[model samples]
Target: MDKMDKDEPRWLNEAELNAWKAFNTLIIKLPAALDSQLRNNSGLSHFEYLVLAALSDAPQRALQMSTLAVLANGSLSRLSHVVKRLVKHGYVYRETAPGDGRCTLAVLTDQGYRKLAGSAPGHVEQVRSLVVDALEPEQIEQLRHISQQILHAMDPDLPCPDRR
Candidate 1:
């Protein structure tokens, strides 16, 4: 007989349960470890580093705020707050779009560019050490596909970040 009652919901099988547990653990711990490294070495949080890195990669080091929010995988409100902090720190500036005044643009300052350049090596090293080096070549490809699948499921309309 099934342990679940007829009225109860379906639950994970043992194999599924184990995978879920490991996935959940990785989701929780990976960010913390990355965050600690960034905060300790660069005085930036992981998210902040992402925001800067995204902008740095943009043409003219500028992007529409909305686009940046998506690239940074954050809500507009959250991105706004981070941008405000970056502005205060003299790393970014916000301005209205030329023809589309309704659209706000985030421009990464030279300071921001320099900061990102300085931190990038450390960030890349951490990423390689913690994730890339840990995975076999086949596993790396699998990870990319799995991540994209999950991202597509979550928001099919959202553009893939790495496609740029």
Candidate 2:
């Protein structure tokens, strides 16, 4: 709280630096690994898979575009582009929300559902292989706690799809 303390750069300590480096590496590598598995197995990017999965989890397999964006952790514009691609592939379609002309709803088509169903097993297996299987039960719980804490720190209002 002193002036000198405030002026000094608060750099990471040795332990903090090591933890950060390891976490940074995981951050860089995990997505690439997941994306590779998804692309190779299902011909979908990780973001695309997230979009489809979010829609598939929704009531009537449809959600408002804004809600979908939040659930997918993507920007509205990015969701729009991906939805357009899905539409072109006969996987999704957009329509004005019933009784709400201003809101656009993105609905997953039957084809999209089928694609997601087909993709889920492989994705789950890859996730298990890479993360779940690597951790003990206690560590899994710890990891969940740590992740939630970090996510809460990043965005206190972040909505969890499962909780919703």
**TM-score to native of every candidate shown:** 0.91, 0.94
Measured over all alpha carbons after superposition, the RMSD of each candidate to the real structure, in angstroms, is: 3.0, 2.2
Candidate 1 lDDT tens digits, 65-156:
99999899899999999999999998999999889989999999999989888998998999999999999999998898889888888988
Q: Which pairs clash inside model 2?
A: none
State the weakest 10-residue window (summed lDDT) of model 1: 155-164
**Model 2 TM-score relative to the real fold:** 0.94
> How far off is model 2, as Cα RMSD?
2.2
Query: Given candidate 2, what's the lDDT at residue 161?
Result: 38
**Model 2: lDDT to the true structure:** 0.93
How far off is residue 160 in model 2, in Å? Answer: 5.4
lDDT agreement with native, every candidate: 0.91, 0.93
lDDT for each residue of candidate 2 in 1-164, tens digit (9 for 90 to 100): 99999999989999999999999999999999999999999999899999999998999999999999998989999999999999999999999999999999999999999999999999999999999999997998788778877887799887533331
